[model samples]
Target: MAFINGPVPEALDREVAATPAEFERDLRKAWPQGVRSDASLSLELNDGALRLTILLEPLEPRRIGLLTLPRLCARYRFEGGDERARTALLTRLDRAMQRGGG
Candidate 1:
């Protein structure tokens, strides 16, 4: 198949060309407890670039003889050169974790 255009214009090319390792190394500096088990964090190094995704499971409905509804799922991603990407991702995940009572 012919391609109309090529890949994205390296939004985070230089900044994250070698960021995956740096991210992992620096995560602990920010969160001393490391990543929690209920949270799923994945970092990918593709074509000399970095991308991060975090998924937090929804809260389970209470089963203590009280009617409860399912919670919403929370997922965040960090891509491109936006300065707030990482901060936003962490904030969302942290909020999710808090909602989960962790």
Candidate 2:
């Protein structure tokens, strides 16, 4: 796994378990509409905060069911970074992680 350098916010860590919807709301605002899909979405607590992970289905119609490719998965930490900035960062990171073998 590719590692990112930084500290996760403790408040987020404490709040994630019970505040999943709020966390997702923040994540959705940070994510891009084009990349968002009708796929599995989950929250994970790691280090000291809430992480968002997505399991993406194949975007290609032909390859979706026939080809058993890996799911486009990504993990993100919602630290106290700027909401706007982190949203863009999350989108880029998601794409990168998806292409970089999770």
Candidate 3:
């Protein structure tokens, strides 16, 4: 896949179960210098050699009986990396963020 403003951007969007602060903290473990806006984040890898822009959209909390779960739509945009590198980056991130699943 072509990165660095070639063709189209490689993006992924997933609904996550956490607050922005929680998600950002986990992200910072990998991307320490990620920039945060009102509801978004811009991350980098390889000392800025590659970029990942994250846009967070808050969604209505899902209520389960007496309990509730936070929800957000996280959009990731990849730039300036090959498919292998990008896939590896995303895989690492996913592994880091996933928790408490059967």
Q: In terms of TM-score, which candidate is strongest?
A: 3
- TM-score of each candidate? 0.24, 0.25, 0.74
For model 2, residues 16-85, the per-residue Cα lDDT tens digits are 2113343345445444342333425554322223233343222322335676433222334455445554
CA-lDDT, candidates in order: 0.36, 0.37, 0.67
Clashes of each: 0, 0, 0
lDDT of each residue in 14-45, candidate 3, tens digit only: 78888878777777775555545453344344
Spell out the clash pairs found in candidate 2: none
By TM-score rank, best first, the candidates go: 3, 2, 1
Q: Report the error of model 1 at residue 50, Å.
A: 24
**Candidate 1 local lDDT, 56-91, one digit each (tens):** 344454444676544423333446544444444445
**Candidate 1 minimal-lDDT segment of 10 residues:** 10-19
Better of 2 and 3 by lDDT: 3
- The TM-score measured for candidate 2 stands at 0.25
The 10-residue segment of model 3 with minimum total lDDT is 1-10
